[model samples]
Target chain A: MIKTFTRNDLIRYIYQETTKEENTEIENALIFDEALCDELGDLQLTVNGLGRIERSPSKGSIDKILSYSKYYNMNAVN
Target chain B: MRKYSVSDSQLISLYKNGNEGAFADLVNRHKNKIFTTVYMIVKDQYLAEDLLQETYIKVVNTIKSGRYNEEGKFLPWVTRIAHNLAIDHFRKAKRYPTIVMEDGSNVFNTLEFSEDSIESQKIKEDTHALLRDLIKELPDSQREVLMMRHYMQMSFQEIAEATDVSINTALGRMRYALINLRKKMDKLNIAYDKNLYQK
Candidate 1:
């Protein structure tokens, strides 16, 4: 019997939050369900897009953080 | 020696033992994720930088004082600190409502895409910038869930606990966040094709 999954299940599946049994079942369902596959594809694309949008902090900010760490260390030693 | 082969827990241990280089490595390894998480919340690069620095200072203090007990979870712990600091900044300044500027321009517009001269690279960067703006447009609950799950790498259950909601509700918010993002992307005619973003 093919078990139907909800959008929430798909979300969990894509995030790898689903259990091992659920993973096998979802993989099986994806092979037979075009709509489910499409939904997963769209969700996966959106997640991937989110992953690509990282911004780095300024070098000066990082330097300040590092210096602060050293300063704290020096103070601790004193 | 391969840089970054050192795990976060290992780095934390080394830093606790007075190795400043280990601490620097830890900072460098997770700085982008922490910065982006704070940036998404505060929506200002400068504020994000300040929060990032503050977050690290807190990390140093916590680790140095031996109060940092979240072993093997450095990124998420620092991210939580950055997230809280950003939220606190808005709360203290009463600037929550001003997240969307009056002039309708975002701080991301000022960022220079100087490294990539290629047209495709530029298009990818532009798309990413636009997506960031759309993320800002999302409802606060949805955006919060997205930030926690995507940027902070928190599991849905953790997000639920952090936000004081059920796990299902957290998952639902994430689903709506992605669906709404897709709708906005379609409305703006941004292509979802992976090939288009390839260099």
Candidate 2:
């Protein structure tokens, strides 16, 4: 009973970028479309999960990159 | 964007006028971004470090020789230089065709944002690792957009400017990336309990 939906529909729903009609359509699909539910669930999880990944670079990497000044630019202050 | 650490525009003006400190400041400000971008493309930390130096030298010389077209705008110009050098590295290693795209499109997986809550953090970190591996298998162009948006904290507008694409294209990439990621995770049967993030 999963109403057939397009990629655009899912995009709108996930971003909450959908209209009320589209939102209702997607929410309704949740009742019948097990696969869609799983996919939507996974999409939410992935977006949320991605929010937890470590975005910062390794410590000292910035210092190491600046180390280049030592070789080329004689006047560069470290 | 308000001269937090001497912005790219300010540094470019200083450097153009022959101020030595400007060069160092510019280097300090962007080293991490340059390093990370290079590392992603080269996939080797050591080589990325080297390419970083090479990228700067080229920028310096390009500016010094007066061949640089970007009069005041520096980061975008420098970024392009770094990207070019990375492409050169892959080319010299005979890996160009596999790595460099004519459109200069390089994509990556969603970034793992760092958090402080230890309790939920551990589970989130585990789930992050799962998605990270799956994303690495994606196309470079797709992966790059996802990484920049999620990890680098770039807005869609910034991403489009950085990637030389339209806003629509950037959003399209993000949309497609999410959908593809969901489909891939589904096939892998990875499960993330909802209660984890609710807290």
Candidate 3:
């Protein structure tokens, strides 16, 4: 059986927070552990899928946001 | 025409200096994230839009009044505003979703968008719709963690701080969420990775 790493350890690995030597350990663990490796892959996919969602702000919306600035300043001076 | 590095601090500085357009530029740049962030909190698109607007308005108001201080990070500043407004809305309404159970098991999981054939984009739309349904099956905590981490681009540390959980706890939730999502995909025969799973 593959050695079980703590969830915190996995998270540390996910965020590149792992030290160089520890990073190698995680990689080696995955190579030896099927379930753990699959779990890591799943997390990778969820993050990738979410990252794929790009922001497409509507046109003219920025104008509205800017207008608020004008209104704020106007109110402040009054 | 000088691009000031596009950092939040630069944008906030520009906006505070009475550059109205700068405020708009910043909002436009981050509006989607703002919208998504608010949407995940409220789970209502229309209301989320309203709160999203309120967040920007408050930012404008704060900056114009010179009440906006240079903080740890400008992006987090606006996000904090958005987060507060969302929490306030929920408190006043006293309404939370049913699916978001105590244990954080709710449906708001996978969000995928597949491509169609060489014809029209109809199939792609269908894929998006299907993905939306799948996400609704995710537990509230999982969905929230997944969306905040993925969509809002918040780190686990940020999520922990924002959601009032320890980093380890947040990580555990996410890990379980992914495992649950994998099971859901399997049940539906969604074939998230047909090639890899086949072997």
Candidate 4:
């Protein structure tokens, strides 16, 4: 019997939180279910869009982190 | 020889053994996501930078003191630290209301768009910026679930435990967050063009 996946199930599938069996089931369902496919597509797009908006810290922030690590190491060694 | 990406565990082990370069690699690998996580909560680049520094300092102290037991889960562990620090700062300063402008639009909406940019790139940036603002407009519970799952890459189970909610509740918030974001995007007439998102 085919499984009826909920939106939460699809969310887990997108995030790769589903088990192997569930993954197989969802992939099969996607083949025959247009609405399911569309829902998954919309969710995936929004997640991907959120990922693309990332901003990096300044170089100075990174430098300070590295320097702090080095300083701690030096203090520990002495 | 083909270049192989080093695992976070390997980098952590190296850093623990006095390899600063490995620590630098780890930071460079995960900095953007970590920074973005804090920036989303704090909403100020400079303050996020400060918190990022503090987060790493805590990370360094934990690792150096031989207390960093989160072996394989480096990114999420670091992200939790950043998230907590940002939340502490947010609580102490009460800065939540400042993100809303007098016109009801978010401060992020005021970011300048370049007139001469390529159309697709412009749209992508505009959409992303607007989406970021929309995220801020979400209910705090929904926003927390979205950030914990989407940005911090925490599992819904982990998010449930962290937020003191049921797993189903976490999943429901994520679902609503996505549905609401889609509805808002459509209302604003933003095209959900997959072609525009291609690298």
Candidate that would win on TM-score = 1
- Summed backbone clashes in each candidate are 0, 9, 9, 0
Interface RMSD of each: 3.4, 6.6, 5.5, 4.1
Taking chain A of model 3 alone, its TM-score versus the true chain A equals 0.62
Q: Model 3, A29-58: lDDT tens per residue?
A: 989888778767777765444432333333
User: What ranges in model 3 sit over 4 Å off?
Assistant: A1-4, A16-25, A28-35, A53-57, A75-78, B1-5, B97-120, B191-199
Of 3 and 4, the candidate ahead on lDDT is 4
Ranking by TM-score: 1, 4, 3, 2
Error of 1 at B100 (Å): 7.5
Instruction: Looking at model 1, give its docking quality level.
Output: medium
**In model 1, where do residues sit more than 4 Å from their true spots?**
A75-78, B1-4, B97-118, B194-196
Docking class of 4: medium
Off by over 4 Å in 2: A1-78, B1-5, B71-73, B96-132, B144-171, B182-199
Per-residue accuracy of model 4 over A1-78 as CA lDDT, tens digit each: 778888889988888899999999999999999999999999888887777667778788999999988899565542
Query: Which has the higher TM-score value, candidate number 3 or candidate number 4?
Result: 4
Q: What are the per-residue Cα lDDT tens digits for candidate 2 across A1-78?
A: 545886545644665556798788789988888878886776677777555432233435445544443343564332
Error of 4 at B1 (Å): 25
In the range B102-129, model 4's lDDT, one tens digit per residue, is 2322232322334335775556666766
DockQ list for all candidates: 0.56, 0.17, 0.34, 0.53
RMSD to native for every prediction? Answer: 3.8, 9.0, 6.8, 4.7
TM-score of chain B of 2: 0.61
| Per-residue lDDT of model 1, residues A1-78, tens digit only | 899998899999988899999999999999999999999998998888776677877778989999999999575542
Give the alpha carbon lDDT tens digit for every residue of B37-146 in model 1. 88788877777878888888788888889898954467778898888898899889986734543132223332344565668555776677788899999999999999
